[model samples]
Target: MAIELAGRPHRVPEGSSLADLLAALGHAPQACATALNGDFVRREQRHATRLAEGDRVVLVQPIVGG
Candidate 1:
């Protein structure tokens, strides 16, 4: 299946969860915030949040500031 990841098209295996995608991208689940189709998906829910075709996924990492 293909999904719009951070505004770019990306292919992923069928039945893939958000956590799976993060792993594939080498992102630690605790180090970023995720949104699906413009809605926020909590970290704890990533394992259960199944991704669908054409779904929009955004992952943002926090930055420390002075």
Candidate 2:
């Protein structure tokens, strides 16, 4: 299936979970915040949240400031 990840089109395996997508993209589950189709998905839910075709995923990482 194909999904819009951070505004770019990407393909993932069928029945892929958010955690799987993150692993495929080289992101650590604990290092970023994720939103699915404009709604926030908690960290613990990543493993259970299955992504569908055309779903929008946004990943944001925390930045340290002075």
Candidate 3:
């Protein structure tokens, strides 16, 4: 299935979850924040957030400031 990942088209196995996508990309989940279709998905919920075709997903570095 194809979905928009980080603003680019990405393909993954069917029924792939947010966690699976992160693992597939070799990204450490703890080091970034994720969102699906413009909604923030908490780290604990990544595994349950199943991705759909054409979904917009973004994984970005978390802002750290004092």
Candidate 4:
């Protein structure tokens, strides 16, 4: 499936969850915020939020800068 993450196209496996996607992208699910199809996906829901075809997923990591 072709899902867009942070404005970049990504090919993720079928039935992959937010956690799975994050892991594939070399990111830790514990350290990021996720949005699927324009709706914010909470941490508790990441395991259950399955990615669908043509779904747009945006994952942004928290950054602290002085």
Per-prediction TM-score to the true structure, in the order listed? 0.96, 0.95, 0.91, 0.87
- Candidate 3, which segments miss by more than 4 Å at Cα? 63-66
Clashing pairs in 1: none
Tell me the spans in candidate 1 whose CA falls farther than 4 Å from its real position: none
Best by lDDT: 1
For model 4, what is the C-alpha lDDT against the true structure? 0.86
How high is the CA lDDT of each candidate model? 0.97, 0.95, 0.94, 0.86
Cα error, residue 27 of model 2, in Å, equals: 1.3
| Model 4 regions more than 4 Å off | none
Which portions of model 2 miss their true places by more than 4 Å?
none
Compare candidates 1 and 2 on lDDT and give the better one. Answer: 1
Candidate 3 residues 1-66, lDDT tens each? 999998999999999999999999999989899999999999999999999999999999867899
lDDT (C-alpha) at residue 58 in model 4: 84
Per candidate, the number of residue pairs that clash is 0, 0, 0, 0
Most TM-score-accurate candidate: 1
Tens-place lDDT per residue, model 2, 1-66, is: 999999999899999999999999898889999999999999999999999999999999999898
How far off is residue 6 in model 2, in Å?
A: 0.5
Error of 2 at 34 (Å): 0.1
2-65: candidate 4 lDDT, tens digit per residue: 8887777888888898888888878876888989989999998988989887889888789999
